[model samples]
Structure formats: structure tokens, C-alpha cells
Target: MVASLLILAVSGGMLWAVGLNYDGLTGGQAQKVHPASYLCVLLVLWQMLRRGNPVANLVSAAEHRPASCLLAAASIAMAAQIILRGASGTAGAIDTFLQAALVMILLLESDARSLRRLETLVHAVMAANAVLGIVEFATGQRFFPFRLDGATFETDTRSAALQGHPLGNATLTACYVLALIAGGGSLKPLTRLVMIAVQLVALVTFGGRSAIVVTLVLGGAFGLAQLLRAIARGRIPLLAAAGAACALPLVATTVAGLAYGGFFDALLGRFASDGGSANARVAMFDLFSRLPLRDLILGPDPSLVDSLRRITGLEWGIENPIIRVVLYQGALMALLLTTAVTLFLVEVGRRCRAGIAMPMIAFVVLINTFESLGGKTTLLAKFVIVLVALYRPFPETRIARAS
Candidate 1:
């Protein structure tokens, strides 16, 4: 039973990391629900039914009270909203939410040893996915059949990796890379460094300007902090630093050689010119201005929003989750979601190590800036996996409950 549980836990993490895109690979949303989604729902129920299981123990544990409660409430509210509102993308959103929620449950209930193994699985899959992203970028080939509503999802430079969407791939890769830097202790120092480099490049290839910029700001800030510590502790000598600085030309030469294939040219060009994505983000605010007071509270009709989109020339739909929540689900649901997310972070932060929790938290907050949680995205589920992988419970709290 223990062995089976371990396998289940690890497999669930792997499933989310690679996220096979089973539902939409060939064409439209062929299956209403993903196979992975069904497996996750079943896993949660199965674990709950089994006595003395981690799920059972966690429910009765003191430390898990806040997080577990929030998870339950949020899950219930999200499902109710989907059923009651029957919003445009509710079918995909609900499945993604449940899978993410249950994965958190599975992780929260596991023993520390199981978490260690799960962490390793997550790292491996993400690293492999980065490599796959590189291959797709180079070959201009999408491993999964890319079709959206019976039409080919075409792109010139960005890769459709396993995530199937360039922006989603960029966001997930950027966030996962950040999470690894935070708490992915399963990887060795060198392996971690390699992944950091590879996935950062993968971030560029995936072509999400927001993800790249956020990563740089946060990652650069973190790197600066580490550099300061090294200097203060005399771990890095002044002479050695100067020598390294002087070697910048050599480093540039090597980097240029690596970029010889021009894989990075497109992203670099995008940095120079965002093709109105920036304007769109700013212009999206105009949506709320046009909405009536009642529409702001109850959310305007989908057809109405569509007409507004056309008028606003936002043919691509709203990209910001902040605006998405209010415009799609109303302010009430938005408030509830914001409250739940805030509680989940606070509860997990105290339990997790500062290093891991801080980056993971930043990733979540920054990611929603560009990626909407209201859409057909596995982003939430993926974030939950990172949360549970690094979660560090109070041992004594669990012990007291067991006694």
C-alpha cells in the first residue's frame, strides 16, 4: 500500500509537470474533461475513503487546518460559480481547478520522504520539458498536434511545447525555474545551474515578454542578494571578482556562438518592439470604464463583452487575470478568489522555508499579471504542485495529532 501510494503521488506530479495536453492535442476540446483531470479527482476521493491514509491524517491535523479549509472553500466556490454562471470557459476552468486542488491535497498529506521523491520527479520532468521546448523551437515542430477549434494553431518563432501554448509554456517554464531556485533541493548545484540557464533561454524561445521581464526583475534581484552575501562573507574575493568581470568579453564570445543559430533573435527583437501587447494591457482597462455599474457587479453578457472586445480592437481577448476575474466572474467572486489565494500563501509561507516560499510566492503573483487563471490553463495546477513539493510542515504538529 505504501509503495502504491508513493507511485501515485509521484505519477500525479509528473502528470502535471509534463501535462500531456490530452484533451486538445489533436484538435478542439475533443474530450470535455482531460484524463489527467479524472485521475486527479479519483485520487482525491480514493485517498479520502482509505482510513489511516495521509489524506485522513492531514484532515485531522492542526497545522493543515487553515490551508485545507481554504482549499475546500475555494474549490466549492469555483465549482458553484461554473455551474451557476455557465461562463464561456467554465468547463475547462473547473477541471483545471479540481486537478490543482487535489494535487495539493495529495502533496499536503504525504510524508516528508514522499515529498522528496515527488520533488525530484517534478524537476526531471520540467528539465526534460525545457529540452523539448528547445527542440521544438529549433525544428519548428510541435510535438503534440496543435489545432484550436478545427484550425491549425500556427506560429513562426515560438514553440508549442508540451503545454501547447507559447505563452503558457513561457509562464510555466519561468515559474518552475524560479521554484527550483527556491526549494528544488532534489537537484545538485551544477544540475540546477544548468536548468536555470537552459530554461531561461527556453523562456525567450517561448516568447512571453511578460514572463521574461518578470523573471529578470525577480531573478536579478535574487542574484544580487546572493552576490551581496558572498561579498560580505568574503566567499568571493575582490581579485577573483575583478578577474571574472574582465573575462566578460570571452563570455560574450561564447554566448554569441551559442546564439549563432539566431534562436534568440526573435525574442530579442520582441524586447525592442512588443507589437502592441503593452498597449493592449493598458487599453484593457478601458473595458471596465465602458461597463455599466450593474455589469461590473454581475458581469456583462458574453456576447456583450465580445462586442466590446471588437470595439476596443482587443481581438485577442483580455490577457490580464486581474481584469479577467472581475470582468468575467464579477467583483464578488473576484474578492472571494483573492481572499482564498492570499490565505493559501500566508498559510504555506510559514510552513515552507523562506527561500522556497518567497520565490514561489513571487512567481504566483507575477505570473497572474500576464496569464489569466480564468482561461483554459494548467497554470494553477502546476503552481499547486510546486507549492506541495516544497511545503515543510511542523513535525511536532503532525506528531501531536498522531498521538
Candidate 2:
């Protein structure tokens, strides 16, 4: 029952998130934001309801075990932001909320009965997301209410719709596709085919080089892993089919590359553009270096956010979440956040032992390659996944009481 509600909350929140503007408020907050985000907050709290101490519940799973220096270092950096800057409190609140949700999931899923329900929820979300994405594409308007502007889904000027941010859309679509794959839920062949078609269309819409790169990297890795497993199992035909399938895409791309100059040119242009150059990041790195040593250890004051805006003519930095946290919060706070998340991921990975964790890691690593993951929404999503993957209640315990 709790898992069902959480799924509804997540679906509702994603719809709202896609619908809302970059500011994250719908209709000035006075007109009323969608109830989805608030619902997500409630779902997160459900983890701790009369459930005994959360920390104590996780104790058997060793969640509070002593963390490594790398982990410690990261959390300290995050803590520094909260203590010194006070800038990230709102975003941090979202992260904490997601963390709570994850804890609940881990606790709830420990039993067989709850695990089945969780699987159902995952598949349902995947189906819903795929349908919404397709409908939005077909209509050429935001699929959900109060849609926001980004690279893909545009609410701004005339040409903006045509040039919708490709990468962001692709990332969102691909994440759902991966979720379906990782969740291990059963689906009919036609439904699976439909999902692939929808995701492919979304991918083309995304048009970000980073998304393309991620697709290639992750696709290659998964293919290799599967092939190795097939070989070990002596599945000769499967190995042959896998090898042939992998070669086909590259071959098709190469053939298409020769026929279209714009395709190759645009691809290369993403790399050559000065504004997108790696040297741009170097400038930010230099700024980090010039700060006082203590700034790296703790963080700048919350007022520094305004200071940073005045200097950069932008609200936030790009390309590195770590750098963003350090600049916005402080070293200590960044460190704390990093440690908590790292530990959470490690714990969940050990418990599930599923390949699902690979794509989650890829999402983070890939985003950091092009843009910072320090945004409140981005961090919140990250923490939510951690919560979902980790939390599973004791079904036996719940059932016994009911019986």
C-alpha cells in the first residue's frame, strides 16, 4: 500500500517537474503549484511513521557504519554549505526528503510481498512516463500542465520549440527506459517495442552530444557484459546475435554519415564551439583555486551566491556538481552530502546486486561531464532513486501483524 502511494507521488512529481518553469514554481505559487511535489513530500515522510527509529532500523543493514575519508570529505563539504552559506537549504531539504523515501523503500521491500508491489509500481511508472512523452511529442506542446522551458520542451520564443534542448529530453526519456529494464518487470513484446520507438523519438529530440555519448558508452558496456555472460553460459547463438546487433548500429551511422554533411558538421560543431569548450571549465577551476584554503574546507557565506551571480552573470556554475556544491554551500556540506549519497549507493548496490545500479551511476557521471548535478531538482531526483533502490519493508513482519 505504501509503495503504491509512493509510485503515484513520483509519477505526479515528474509530471509537475516537467510542466513547471525553470523557477520550479507553477503560476507564482499563489496560483498554486501542482500537488504532485507536495505528495512526494508526504510519501517521503511515510517511511518514518511509527516505524521505530529509522537509524536503528537501518542499523542491521549497517547503513550508519563508519564512512571512508572520501565519503567523509564529501559530506563535510556539503555540511559546510549548510553551516556557512545557508544557500542550499531549500535544495538540501529536497535531498533529505528523497533520502527519507529511500530509507522507507528499503525497509518496506525487505519482505517478499512488498517487493512484488514495488515491482508493479516501477513498471507502472515506466509505462506512464513513456505514454506521456509520446503524447507530448505528437502534440508539439508540453504533455503535462504548466510546462517548463529547457533545451527540449520549450515555453519561450518562437524558434525555441524547434530547437528544444535535445540532451535533457533524451536524458529524461532514457532514464525511464533504463528504469524499466532495471526493474525486471515483465512486459509484452509489443509493449516493449512501443517503448523503444518512443524512447528513440525522444532521443532524437534531445540532440545533446552528451546523451549520444552516454548512449554509446552504456550501450557498449551492457552489450559487452551480456555477451560475456552468454559466452560463459555457452549460448553460442546468443553471442553471435549480440555481436551482429552491436555492429549494425555503427555501420548504419557510418553509412548515414557519408550522405549528410549537416549530420557530421553539427556533431563536430558541438565539440568546437568556444562557449562549450573544456577551457571554459578551466576558468572555473582557477577560481576555485584562488579561494582561501578554508573556503575549500568549509564554504563561502550564503551571501556569496549573490556575489557569484554578480561575477559570473549566471545563477550557478556548470559541469561539476562537486564544484557547484563547494561554491554554493561550502566544502564541509558538500563533503557530507557526497558521503551520505555515496554510502547510500554502495549499500543499495550490495543489497540488490542487480545491474540496475550501473545506469544510475552512469546518469550521474554523464551529467557531471556536461553540466553540474548541483541543482536542487537534480539532487532531489538523485536522492529519490537512492531511496527507492534501498528501502524495502519487512513483508513478513507486516503480514504477521495483519494475520
Residue lDDT tens for model 2, 1-403: 4533443333322444545443343344321222333454455355445466766644533432223223323433444535454353453334333433343344433455655665565545544544554455445555333233323323321111111223334454455455444433455655665565555444543445565566666766775888699889987686657767986897688648743734344345555763434654665665565567786666666565446544754432455766766776667666666666666556444444345564566566655654434653333343334334323323444534766
Q: What's the TM-score of every candidate structure?
A: 0.82, 0.65
**What is each predicted model's overall lDDT from 0 to 1?**
0.64, 0.47
TM-score of 1: 0.82
Candidate that scores best on TM-score: 1
Worst 10 residues of 2 by lDDT: 156-165
Q: For residue 102, what is the lDDT in candidate 2?
A: 43
Runs off by more than 4 Å, candidate 2? 1-88, 96-110, 134-139, 144-183, 188-194, 224-234, 237-280, 313-316, 370-372, 378-403
The numbered model that scores best in lDDT is 1
